[model samples]
Target: MNGTGRIQVARKVVGVGSVGTRAWVLLMDTLNGVEPLFLQAKEAQPSVLAEYCGRSQYANQGERVVTGQHLMQAQSDIFLGWTRARGDDGVDRDSYLRQLRDWKFSAPIEQMIPEGMTFYARMCGWTLARAHARSGDRVALAAYLGGSNAFDEAIADFAETYADQNERDYAAFQAAVDDGTAQATTEI
Candidate 1:
């Protein structure tokens, strides 16, 4: 929440993923049009990985998501919070809330130059390594990784297999849509 008296300047649904509903809200101080704040709220549900990894410790799914993000990210949004609201089914559902942006811009992944892509990939790898090191024994991980390309090759193979499986699943989904078994809305 804003410390000062900020009013809701605008609000809209964010057209992105199909996982759940997401909304963007803009707040502005009446006197300062240049310093508007934007926040995004997203509906949260039990993670699919829960089936194999066991249940989350947090009772609310929103809290679980926000907490996990806080743990994994080096820098987190200060406004991150969680709330529960009645869903369309008349049941309470959890939602994660946070600032949509904080002077940070995203690189257009599809249009990035090769050098930019390489930089982005390396940055992502470093960030992930930091997260892993924070959550696990750095020495043990280093030992496991070793000074070899074997692990890298194995990981690449796994990624290839995963991508192939994803493509096959997409094909099945397309077939279902064609046969009227499933209907997909692209407007989102």
Candidate 2:
């Protein structure tokens, strides 16, 4: 809210990691409703790694999330911010906000053949490594990893197992739907 604007609507939204969280898409406009900006306000709870990594240093979870994103990304969203609000459950919640969507090119992952897919995977791997390195965890993690391919192999095995689980979960869901135990609709 760097300038004058009015909120148009606040629509509830949810996704994979945000299930049961108070998340919303805030629609707003300025200049007599000619320009519209959609912001996604997602509740920031304790990090999933908190049990193992301990709590974040920042007092506000939203601020911690925003700070981590800033540290991790080379080009973060200009609208990235954080705030506190009273949730529908009458509880105070911290949330991180950012542009709902930003323009950028995405690889044609589905269209890639096996060789292309391998290249894309390596590209993605390097990008993630670069981000982690930039975030100042490079030295400690590198020292812990030492000089071996065991960690790499373990990660690869874990990824394959995770993908296999996802397939099985989707198949079970489809089976449940087919048996009338569950329902699904594509018309969302």
Candidate 3:
């Protein structure tokens, strides 16, 4: 972005859940300020669920994320990549980069109409089924899911229980931090 572009700026991105740091980067051509490219960088860390799911084969945590995205989505962002860099504290970190919005749309859930929410739910189900079909045995999926809502309800129940456990764990961690037994750093 030197002679080709004028200056590149990085803006802090908020609201997104990340294990570590996240930011939005903008690159623009200084000459006309017309050529603009927006990129998102998110820190990658070892997954908390990895212990139960099994060890990842990717050397870098970023690669694990990239691979999972590719497998779960029919189409992935064109500018997806991964890199490692040394932080100011002399610690190496892994991060993944992708276009901020390649072909995406979003709307507040609170603003969605009932009909629209139903349609959206159907679409989400279809997309998840497709992803499972691509990565798992179709015959087995058909057999497991069957022709009823039993499997779906079971999955929902499991998710609720899992979330309750996670909340308990988080509360314990917060108590430790409050008691000065553990330190929680919110900003870097």
Candidate 4:
């Protein structure tokens, strides 16, 4: 941002994954007031796996996000950073900030055919492998995996069980909504 323009900060309440997390967008005009630089800050909380996986070495969840991004990604956002802030509620929260070049993008899974879905699934597998290759101890992982398909089979089994549980959870939520135990709202 440059010149005499002002920055505006707005809360983004919709479409962000995992509802109830605080997300904010900051817009600052560059040069004149026409071109705007967009930065977004999202609340970072402790991992859901913390109970079994222990705690993150980084006390600040924001710093943990930044560090994990740097480790698992080849190229990070230009202004990727982190901070801990005490809000009006007097509670401190860790948040990761990044230049919001794009709001977000996703594949049109609804329109994909079986073949396209297979390809998409393979692509996702490769991407996850790449991230793990970058972050994990490759030698140790190779030693554990060896030249066998046992690890692959075990992983597939776990994934299937996980997906099954997700489906059950979703069904439960739907039942709750239908019975008036939970409320559903539409955006816009």
Q: In lDDT terms, which candidate is top? A: 2
- C-alpha root-mean-square deviation, each candidate: 5.2, 3.2, 6.5, 3.7
TM-score to true structure, per model:
0.63, 0.78, 0.66, 0.74
Error (Å) of candidate 3 at residue 176 is: 24
Best by TM-score: 2
- Best first by TM-score, ranked: 2, 4, 3, 1
lDDT of 1 by residue, 1-188 (tens): 35655667344555656335545464645454567667766778788899999998999999998988887777889989889977557988788888877677777999999999999988977877799677667799899899999988997799899999999999999999999999998999
Candidate 3 at 61: error in angstroms? 1.0
**Cand. 3 TM to true fold:** 0.66
lDDT of 3 by residue, 1-188 (tens): 55766756675655647524655575655577776677777778877788999878888888888888888778888888888877678998887889877777765678999999988878877888799787778898798789999988998899799999999999999999999999999898
Residue 11 lDDT, candidate 1, scale 0-100: 40
Error of 1 at 174 (Å): 15
List candidate 1 stretches off by more than 4 Å. Answer: 1-18, 22-36, 87-89, 107-117, 156-188
The models' CA-based lDDT, in order, is: 0.79, 0.89, 0.79, 0.87
- How many steric clashes between backbone atoms does each model show? 0, 0, 0, 0
Tens-digit per-residue lDDT, 80-169, candidate 2: 999998876798999999998877677999999999999999999998988888888788989988999998999999999999999999
Local error of candidate 1 at 91, Å?
2.6
Better of 1 and 2 by lDDT: 2
